[model samples]
Target chain A: MASNVSTKNTNNSNKNGSSSNSVISKLKNTFGLQQLIILIVLFLIYGLFAALSPAFRSGSTLTSIFDASYYVGFLALGVTFVIITAGIDLSIGTSMMCAAITGGVVYNQLHAPLWVALLVILAMATAVGCLNGFLVAKLKLPSFIATLGTMMITRGLSSILSNVQTETFPLRGTSDGWYKSIFRTSGDFPTGAIVLIGVAILCAIILNKTRTGRYIFAIGSNREATRLSGVNVVRSEAMAYIIAGFCAGLAGIAYAATYTTIMPGSGAGFEMDGIAAVVVGGTSLAGGVGSILGTLIGTFIMTVLKVGLPYLNLQPHYQIFITGFVVILAVYADIYRNRKKNQ
Target chain B: MKKKILFGTIFAALLLLVGCSGGNSSSSSKSSGGNSKNIEVVAKGFQHDFWKAVQSGAKQAAKEQGVTMNFVGPKDETAIAEQLEMLNNAVNKKPGAIALAALDTKAEIDAIKTAQEKGIPIIGFDSGVPNAPKGAVKATASTDNYKAGGIAAQHAYDAIKARIDSSATPPRIGIVSQEVNSLSISQRTGGFIDKMVQLLEANPKIGKGKVAVTGHDKFKNKVNASSAKAIIELRVPADVTDAAGKTEASALLKKNDTICVYGSNEFGAKAIINADDSVGGRIGNTEGKVVAVGFDSGKLQINAIKSDKFLGSVTQNPIKIGYEAVSLAVKAAKGQKVKNIDTGVKWYNKDNVDSKEIKPLLYQ
Candidate 1:
């Protein structure tokens, strides 16, 4: 077990740089000071909340933070690709709810097995992604406008399909309840955090390593230039939306596992939460620059504040109010970086 | 980099501390329970004045019991996942006891299970987590909305009896409900319909073949709308929105035979009041006015009652719901026997609306 831990650490250090001195030293070259500061800030805020409220430092409270972050973390990771391609997916939030409810309806109404319902959720979300890709890439619709339309359409569709009733997944102890263990176990371990971190790492690889990743950056940097250079800009940009849809599907699964009751007309504000995390993670709205690692840190920051504020007996609105300032500060950092580079 | 980091850290710390200090003072003032034995309350969002009344009541109970309380809810009712997170955090606090108004019970199963296992007794309030695990929920504090609905019907029946009897043409009774999906809303709608129908049947002039119930396919019956001596029609909108509710209410108001109308909650009552404007202000009880009876109180409904525009409204006493929840929670935490507490309802009109007894119960 110790060897396993050491190997994972070795793998992580190899990915970041070479020999592991300090994690900050390893990451500073690739990500620079922005993410390091944000990382420190996330811990600092957490420490402050713990100092103020004795309950905030409990193990269960950490689990609550992980529970809250799962869906949004998956969402932020997925939308990172699209944001890098200079596009936005307004439908991911509603689309995730719509797809998950359809999955639940399949399980209950169709009497399908739980696994089949889970697959249907993934397939339905990907299909929404395909539609998004087709509209923006083939039909040349504005990504924002196209996704906005799908957002409304999917929002209505979920209600129509579920008959406006709430759909619930199996409880953690039921016959088909093992799916919940994918996120959390009966022993109170939060396995979802591990799954989320793994997905984030994989998303980072896809965004930074592969051809689709490079093409996405190119298109965001200069769409006309990328197109003129014989890269299939439409297909590459569309792939980003498709990736987002796939992530939304994963997010839907995480949502179902973590919070079993799925309601229609929900998942609307979720996209904004996801988008805010991405923006807060040092991703420019103008696109072409973002890291999954930064996005991960951003997700933690958001979830920590959300879970921590309540420990101090603060209302949820304070989280939103403070997060607004945090996002503004992060965006200013991006603007400052761009200004410095131009000068 | 050091200066920027220091500045950012200070900025975030200052904001967080400001929030902490400011929020703690307000919450402490709300309860004044220095004992630090926390009772966490997770409620349905404050969609209307209803929840504010509930909060005030919770504060009342907390102050009396000498237990600090932390109250939180999602931004809106549809945010079920967010509510679950709140419930989970409530459990995580390991409060002395928990008072929960679950938005979706099935979604709350896991968190409730955790609370149960941890030996933290949970008191359900305001449509408490129905069908929760066998022993997870200790007791519930809520108005029996169906009973509350019946209370409205009894009052409405009294005011409209003469109107229905004197009408030469078969009089029509209308019901404007917000939606039919939720247990609380639907029960209120069903309760009023069933009770009013029962009351109308017992009357010598309007028995058996007189009442025809119709609308939304849920309440359709063999009695024809045109042929029956009187009609009991239910109007549930396509969605829960003010405009849709107003439209449904207006459709009933425009009909010439309609002599009385009922709205099940604050939203429904407000819709009826708003719809009355488009139809030349017909709702009242003085003479030829269409008698209107409503459930729950709001500013508009209170004003309407003051002017005799509405005959009366049934109020659920949300503050009592909040108060009882914390009281029950404290009892359960003390390992004392606890059972379901019905934080009953009241009917108020111009006669009693401003009276000391009824004034505290009415919201807005």
Candidate 2:
């Protein structure tokens, strides 16, 4: 096993050495083929929608897309770390709901400040992530069941917390109020895109540069092996969750800002889209081998598909079939590619 | 674990601080007796412009009445259970009065009764709890949805009669509704079916009385129902007939020859309009082209109607309903007797589409 690990490391270094200068290296270094696919898909979707509906290419439309993308994007980014470790966090969607409602209840209904509301969101999300990590890393619970339970609990709590309704911030006009431009897009581009870009850059830095990031990849590659090598498996897993929760909190805030209302049921069934983006963008669900760049492009592609399909006069029901097909195709491709890598 | 809990608690505290600060800066200075007594209007989700229009009307009435109004609803339109829970919470606050768009007709009775017991009158808007004890709230102000459906059928028959020769094959019609249980939706569909049946009986010609009203009734009648058989055998009237049930019926119409498709709600209408590009075949001598009419205002429905994919639809005065509901609620809450207010529905077509009467109610 040690020899195999050493050989795999040597091959990774050797491959990195061979294609160090080409544009291909730059693309691979950033996001790789998945990013390219995402870009192509986004453009194709834009063109198709633009042709079908004249309003599709308008600045407002683009802004709306950016607005829609912000929360989902943040959720995707947070989960990217968790995914890279071959773990899934199904709780992000409900966790987002809990955070948003907690913030809304604290800030809006209770008349709290913006910072306090935001802190509550982040703190709630982080804590949930920690709990998720505890079950998975320490108690040895399967990631699926742990997160699923958390998802159900969080969803119930969100509904309980807000009592099921879109809670308005009650801050119609305040100078310090972040409503006007909290993670906003300006001019032709939404500020959400800028935030997405910022997050992408930060995630890239973390995945590519940080020790914790490296440890995440190592753990993803082989958990037991990393543990045998004297790494704190529990700590690394917990960190991944903490990061995931923080991203969810950020997403909750961005969602509240963009939509201007936090509905407990707002982020329903959105986690699958994040997982789909990551997987479609070349992140293997098997863990250890994924890129934030790929995930961004994947998200872009999914978003495009979501927005563009309806404009083509396709029934909304058909989207379910399309999404299901894409998910199956992605998982199959991942398994195939991972098998090839092993051989 | 303790450290995580401590961090979570501290973070929660910080959130409280941020929330408090944001709230403090936004406090209103102009009381004007509006903020003195808060009036809560609980709506069913605001996905469509209908609820927003209702809120606006309610707000206008509230402002005139010197009351502060707050609007709230679940995100998903169909989540009635959530709305019920919200009503309970609102009752605890002891607001001046509660105006609601009940998600569930029967489940809300208990809550409405509780509000009544507390002297917090619950006036329903858009949707009502018909059996909310006695004087649970003075009266309901909403569109006569059933008559609206009948009105749609009348328009469809008029259009068909004017266009088609009576000597030719009688054009068969189909109806689709969004939900089997939605009282308003079902009533509208029933009205349409009733009108269509009347037309068929009077003429003794359309489909020789074989035009099956395949919706809730058909499903209920079925013994060990096969969805496939239902899909294949059910004859819908048009591609996108609004009010709901339009999508499923539209898809079924494509497979079968349906001349006129009727959707019972906005979702049903959207389903038909959405299937416009891919639809084919004729029901009887209608050229395999099923003339569709929809309910509510959706981007797809608007575009389709503009492009002639659908003929037109019945328009409900949702804003007026909203305005009247709030006005009535406020009056009743203040110990004044207010009778049931009727915000009528009207037939809308391309000719009068831009008119003020039809414009406000259209789903854009």
Candidate 3:
């Protein structure tokens, strides 16, 4: 499986070298042309919105964009790994909300310290992810079905735990509200943006520089061949889901910080945004190809469109339609680029 | 193949267990006695404290009236199809009467017709189906949402009239409506916009200058906009989420000329408060403070009003709406003439929020 992927990469690079001898084309080939094109599209959307609405260019609007992207960014980053492993984690959205709601219950109902509740959020989400991994890897359940069941379960659990009440975290001025500053400061600075970038850098390292990452790519490329090579394919596959779960945990914390009120059943559609971001970032749903940096860029593109649509005198509904088109375009670009390489 | 079969069996058993547990938990009450009349009350949803209050009110009425009240609702307001299914199930039971808070007025018309065909009476609450077929709906119990909105507009106008008269440019008042799809919300937003415009035009000082009502195509089409001394800007979020509400509110609150803002529901009110907290915008009639008014009461909104974070709010009597709905249903069940009941609304502020008259109506 490893040799197969390496050979394909070489073939694509050779195709690029033969197709275009220009220095610019070589630069594009070196950097990955698909990622470059996506980056250009992201900037074009941002620049267009800025040009259309003066308010879109302000510092505060930039802060709002960053605030909106943190939770989705973490989800996208984690799910990118699962997608690359030829798997899906539909539970991340609800699991993130449920984790946050559990943290709220611990803080408000059990009188736990704020720090303890934060740890509880991370632990709970990771635990859910481990469950997802166990179902998919150990039991041989499909990732889609396992995560879908987990999604409904977590969503119901959240509603039951919170008792259908909106769980509000402490506001910034309150004594226990200092934790909010982890994502955003009282002065409205986008501290979460820095945290997201740092997390992305770490994920990029894991995906590029580690044995587990290589094994994951190998398993996705050819699971049977990877097992034949005497690799623990089950453990490697499970690790991908565990990584997604950890990211979901972090996403829970980010969501709690950005929108202090956590309502049960409200996070149902959020996972789609994360999945869309991963796909738009050039991560193939078929697996074995993705990057955390590309996911980050994709997250910004989505956030920009969400925050900018209202400023251009367009209603929020238009954002969904335009985003749908952009996702289709990004995936089409991916398929088109791959077809070119094959030819 | 053996492992797959084992997994499938376990999964099936787990699903069965979950299904049984869900059925047991959701069935709140069994039929009390053979002689007791059964009345089913289908609410919008149990997503908020408001619906819980409504359920309690219905239960209280049931206990007093010596009837069996089975209260059920969908998980959230967006589940209209689920609600319709529940309504159909209620009809199948042949209840003496059904009290409904219809999520979609049009969607319920057929169900109402079916209930009528089955000789079951339907009583509407919270939101009434204005266009229901004749005799399909016996009566309705609800607050006059339009008047409630006018109350909000009245208080807001009183606070900002001086500023409106004195500002060199047109002063803006923003309304953050949760959605336009719901009859209650649309009426509330429209009520406020129309009343605010009416007050502006009625005042000699403001009427001398033009009055413009803009933003939100639904409300914009209803009012005339000209070069005016006052502008009422209405904003409705694409969806009913805290993030969307906050975004819409923040956009309106950020305007330099915005002197007042009104959130038309609990979510909308919280959104306004959240935006104010983010931007450090004060909420009161004092100089430089943007007066904030809200509709509906929640713990957050109540605290905000108490802390002077809001000018005041217009609150509906949800408990009364529930009680009246069941009462009307029972009356219709008895073959008596039942008329639409106004559950009423009141404007509460920091000074009167704890008053006896206002305290009972305030839900968590």
Candidate 4:
């Protein structure tokens, strides 16, 4: 009886050990633990900045970066999903501006109830995204050119809608409403950082654990093969653009929250930051691979550098020079890695 | 399967929660303050740091005066179209009063006219509505821009006169005016020209009232002809096409020596001082190089003045103008009549830039 009981216990222990090992192996295989190295590098860079500038570590300073980061970070995340499919989205930034401005007009100017305005913004953003997807996937236009066209059109549309200045949310004499609450919560850096983290997790789940996510990567890696496998290439690419657009709307709302009014050209030149973050985050511009985590960390690094350098008394324009250097270094490293992988 | 379900459930739940909460929060923000007795005061816009400073000052005044200030405008730089639309929308809302910096002097008159008809008092600031109908505005509070321009010209003469007195030959002077049509920039140029003319009349030996015609000497003589020569050889920034000479100011300095560079506006001033050719080198018999004077206080201009790169600049009480504009609106809303107020401008050299009164004008 004693020997039988010992045998049962030993069998249970062995089963548990193998299950844990399989889980570890699965995590390693699926998520790419190797990329955490970049995260560590980002952390070290942040640490260096925090140590160098007294203001860099201050709550207000950190918060300022976080505040700026939320808009940029959200845009980067949306672009990440698009990039993973080996596509690009240049219109996300302007589309967000258009969405915010349109929403502002509805909610603030026209006095439409706040939720109605938000839905209008969401619908507008999604429609623009759909238009981008339709041109790229359905109409067979090059993703780059398609989005570039969208960027111009959306920018022109935003200007035409607002006539030129930022449309203030909640209007004057009205308190901030639902639009402001979701996107413009008060409290400094961590609030923005926390919001970004929450959104990042949602994107990670959508990208990594979903069927659409798998198809995005598969299509990016080998479009012909993905088609042969009976996955709809057009749908996958279109979906990517739609996702990017939805995220842009989210980013726009975030921007309106943090800043009092959206400036004309508010989202202008922001696509560069998204592209930079995606490229730096280890997404090959050529297609088939990316890291949401890497992009998140990349955003942090960029935002910190942007906010920290200026606080350290370095001129604002000088930060652009450093960012260019970082992008070059990232691309060089990526090329080196590709060569190693090929070998 | 359970994990996937949980994820799906959470995602759906989150969306619903955000959607529901978003609806509730926006309504709450809209209703955060139920006091309808408050007068709505809309600022023209906050595109630049100058606007931000003005907004802050106006808000402070609003709080002290127990009025609500609604500061909103187009988010773009120099977007008059958006400003015009906002004015129309503000008037539609029937705000107690609206304070505006007319985006265009003439384009916004219709909206101002309508708002006046509605009995919503309008107070103009910074760039006042010059063409508003007689009864359209309650009062205008701004720097006497014409006077301010005249001051800039007077200072230019003072600085140049001292240098000319010490020189063997007459010193050539250059003017950088922003827009020929912009009353402010043109007035400053006019004031400077008027002052130079007066000085020249007073001392003809100094070569006053003389126009230096470069390029075609024949064109110089035909003042009324199509290609008439300039009386004063001015090197306006290329961006200022209408300013007698539209070539970049640097080219103007290169073409003529004995040039005393005066920037008629902020952009003109910045371009003149920052130009590579603006290095200190003697102009003709003048022992020192071109003395650069500009209008407006920007960080670059302030620092330049501090370092003696510029002789001095005219500092307008931009914040005072914004604050008074809002205050006047509130008073006018309450049936109190407010007259045109002069916020005023002052000249700041390196020595005075650090002074308490001047420091507030220098954002940096």
The candidate scoring highest on TM-score is 1
TM-score of each: 0.83, 0.50, 0.50, 0.52
Report the Cα lDDT for residue A54, model 4: 39
lDDT of 3 by residue, B1-364 (tens): 3323433443344334323433443333234223127787888887577887787788889889988777877777766544655565566456678899887655455457667886888898888667777988889999999998999999999998888778777788898988888678898988988888889889877673367778867777433455566788988888778888888999988898888999998988999988887788656657888889999888889998998889899998878888998899888887788999989898999999999888878887
lDDT of 2 at B102: 76
* lDDT (10s digit) by residue, model 4, range A1-343: 2221222223223324454655544433423532555566566556655654332454545555665687789889989878877788989988988898898888767898878877787888889999999998899898889999999998888888887756766521246443444532332225556678898888877776667876787777777877998988889889889988888887877766655366555566787788788777777776666767778877886776666553333333456766776777667655654554344
lDDT tens readout by residue for model 1, A1-343? 2221232233335434445477534334434556677788788788877776666778999988898899999889989888877789999999999999999999988999999999999999999999999999789899999999999999999999999888889988899999999988988899999999999878877766677877887777668877998999889989999989999999999999998988876788899989989988877677666778888999998898888877767687776787777777777777765564344
Q: Would you give me the overall lDDT of model 2?
A: 0.66
C-alpha RMSD of each candidate structure in angstroms: 5.8, 18.6, 23.3, 14.9
Off by over 4 Å in 1: A1-30, A134-142, A223-230, B1-36, B153-262, B266-283, B287-291
- What TM-score quantifies how close candidate 3 is to the native fold? 0.50
Residue A282's C-alpha lDDT in candidate 1? 73
Model 2: residues >4 Å from true position, as ranges?
A1-31, A163-166, A171-177, A185-189, B1-364
Residue B264's C-alpha lDDT in candidate 1?
Answer: 92
All candidates: DockQ: 0.35, 0.02, 0.01, 0.03
Better of 1 and 3 by TM-score: 1
Q: Model 4, residue A87: displacement in angstroms? A: 1.1
C-alpha lDDT of residue A169 in model 4: 60
For candidate 2, give the lDDT of residue B73: 70
**In candidate 3, what are the lDDT values of residues A158-253, reduced to their tens digit?**
999888766777766579989889987866677998999999888877776677877777676667777898989889888888899899989999
